[model samples]
Target: MTLVPPVTAAFTLEQSCFGKLRHSIRAFAGSFRPPQALSLRTAAHPSTSSVIVGFEASTWLRSPINALHSIPGRHVTIAFRTEVSDDGELSAWDVQSRKGQYDKVLNALWEMDLRELRVLRIDGLRWWGDQKQLFQERAYPFPPTQDDEAPLFARAWNVEVLILTARSDVSLLEALTELPAARNKLLFPRLHTIAMEWPRHESVSRSIVVDLFQKRHAAGLPVRTFQVLRKGGQDERWEDLLGFTQVVVHDSASE
Candidate 1:
């Protein structure tokens, strides 16, 4: 009989048992390998954040993760959800808190302590402060703001994969245009992949936005593979429109 270390046994069994039960088990195990002594292409940094609701990270912790004013030299994906606020309409207090969040994330990234940082998936971005009559009382919709754009632009210009959920806003591009590096037309210079999720919109026409993106992409920008997954049945045109950036759009519904 052979004896096995509890930790290794647990891990191996978990891998086996879950591998048969779950599709993501293999990837999850793969990510468990020890982090290497980062070998970066350029002197850059990257961190990845998930944009899912409960996973939204507070900006206060950026420094500890980013290692204080020193940019990571390799591909560092700074992961963050594009949506900062739960409800889009920022009350006076919400705005203050949001600003504080922005300051924390940007100050850390702006230190240029990273080689590359990418903004990952943002799903379920509702219209800023729109009203929907649910039961009786009126409620405020979530508002996406300009302040949230700095860290994103900083990462996009410097990182590898920028993944966003379908509900993300077009305003992200506006914010990119204002970045000091991007203003000089260097936003996403190092970007290789953009994973997007396109939400359905009845009133909004996305062609205008897609056209603008293509023009910029041709001008030496960082957009590489653009992929979109449509979840909510808002429209099918989004898939075609997303192609302007040469992005592949997948139908989440089919998956």
Candidate 2:
């Protein structure tokens, strides 16, 4: 039997009102708003298939909030920037602040009633901090503790494909581990494909992709598929991607 392609759609929201944006998208696609909770089976329409969301610009704190939670959809993808500055110099406040933001988003998504979730993607990240001056930095850093990234999507209805790109920090490797839950858990127990792309030589990224696969397999979530794509910022295949996905990546290079 030919596998049916899942229904997919993309979403982009501004930074200022991402909180509301999250609720809006969920209400629109999910068939219920924040103040309400509905079963995915009941909410899904005859036309409902699969949807994918992408954030082109950096929402910073807002990005995590929008992504951490699992929506009652077919698929979801989240991407962010990852470029660390002064490798060894990192700070405590930076780590905590970034983790805190992600925590907020995850906490919210965790509260939803997701049922048909399939694919999940987190990408375009940059890590910049100094170990010696971690606390003195004004901007918060990301990929907090390797432990913090795992709890975001412990239960994703029926996720099948997973993808990660441009992640300079290895902390996300933990994202693959399924959080043990009560019986009849709706988590991604049948995930099939996993894809991740990072800067070629960044040991952090290399170690992460390796560890992610190993750990998930050890945990009985053996990955059935895998793909790695190098992210080269704008020079990367933005146009090719647009053509491939039939979604315009926008010609901003000249602007």
Candidate 3:
């Protein structure tokens, strides 16, 4: 579905006593604004239509339930970003903190009302830390294992598009390999599109990419579109890739 440009609204106060009062009111109202990175849109008409919500930088800090409650729609696409430090080095504490924050958001998502959400796009996740240590320490933020049944974003039956963008191929591999043992039973049953992004220069072998989709298919996910996005490169031949009927490669100069 085509997404409309995000709509923004603003209010200004005049330079007068009443304006000062209005300014105060606005300030008070602003305090109640949705948490950072959360954006909601309601339909202009009364018809039962879809809505779109966007969460940008550092979305894991806030709960999305409250913002979602105010909107009504049959189909919703939640676009969000997870930001990690881009610095060259990271402490163990930094990794742990990132994991904790991500888990918090994951748990919140699992508990949220997803009766209308149809798509979830993690537009981008920046990880500048030690990749090996990150995965070794914690599970990927979605589809909590049977050990933790409550944080199940992957189990949401309504979700169709699951787009995950990572900073590197290792990060993507870590996410896929860290899935629970009973992954097939705990997978995205209704997911139709699985898109992943990473740098082109990252040393991701074709086998790794192929194996990821193979695992998804083995898990009973009827994913129809398999997309790969890289910073710069011609589309690679993915005809040999199993699982998805369509494989798309995208190159972005500015990625």
Candidate 4:
């Protein structure tokens, strides 16, 4: 009703629009405030309390393992997987490359401080290339070599749980039996659980399992649980023969 200058009228309208816009923005932002109960729930969850670091062979070269040192956690498990072939066969050149990769990973682990490492699991393709098939074709036994760095790394870290799974022409049983007596007696001294996954077609005798446990005991390794997991059916007969209270057979299909 009062006469006002044209500029004053326009400025008042602009200021009113800006004020409304700011108020709306503030209300929208406030709506997103997280509930206090959600924060408490996240703090209490078990999975949230632990940290896991995983590595794949393809990406391992690009990433630095030392970055794990900065993560905060009371427990940590390092899981690594290596794939050797596009078709499950390693060529002559591939063998050298694979060995180099393995050595690099071993060296990294050895150099790192792993006081919080609770478990280590590695799954990979056969390391032996076509040598096993070649030996069988020529009617000769394939000689297996023990991994020197693996035991030393496990012993140094004092890993509590260890799991190894690889599909190769070489039998895991044979490799375990072939472990040098000197190293076998000292490897995995703090290991509480050991799990091995052999190929589905492989057949391991009950005596081999018993011998493995006996060797571990002799080595002063405090192993309390031993598990052999395979992908097929299970036979309860081994339970009676194993005689060890900690031995258990798991069928991977069911679990």
Model 1 lDDT on a 0 to 1 scale: 0.34
Best by TM-score: 3
Query: What is the C-alpha lDDT profile of model 3 across 1-255, one tens digit per residue?
Result: 332334342222222211122233222212332112222211112111111343232232132222222221222233223334578465898667655544333333323444434555442233332222222222454444455423233334455555543422434443443453334443346656655654344565566767766766666654677666654555467776744547766665464
Give the CA lDDT, 0 to 100, for residue 230 in model 4: 54
Candidate 2, residue 170: lDDT: 43
What pairs collide in candidate 4?
A: none
Residue 189 in model 4: shift from native, Å? 1.5
The best-first sequence of candidates by lDDT reads: 3, 2, 4, 1
Best by lDDT: 3
Q: Is candidate 1 or candidate 3 better by TM-score?
A: 3
lDDT of 2 by residue, 31-138 (tens): 242212121110112111122332221221122222323333332322221222255454886555544444333323333434544545543222322211111111
TM-score of each candidate structure, all chains considered together: 0.41, 0.43, 0.46, 0.42
Q: Model-by-model lDDT, in order?
A: 0.34, 0.36, 0.40, 0.35
lDDT for position 12 in model 1? 18
Q: How far does residue 127 in candidate 4 sit from its true spot (Å)?
A: 2.7
Q: Sort the predicted structures by TM-score, highest score first.
A: 3, 2, 4, 1
| TM-score, predicted candidate 3 vs. hidden true structure | 0.46
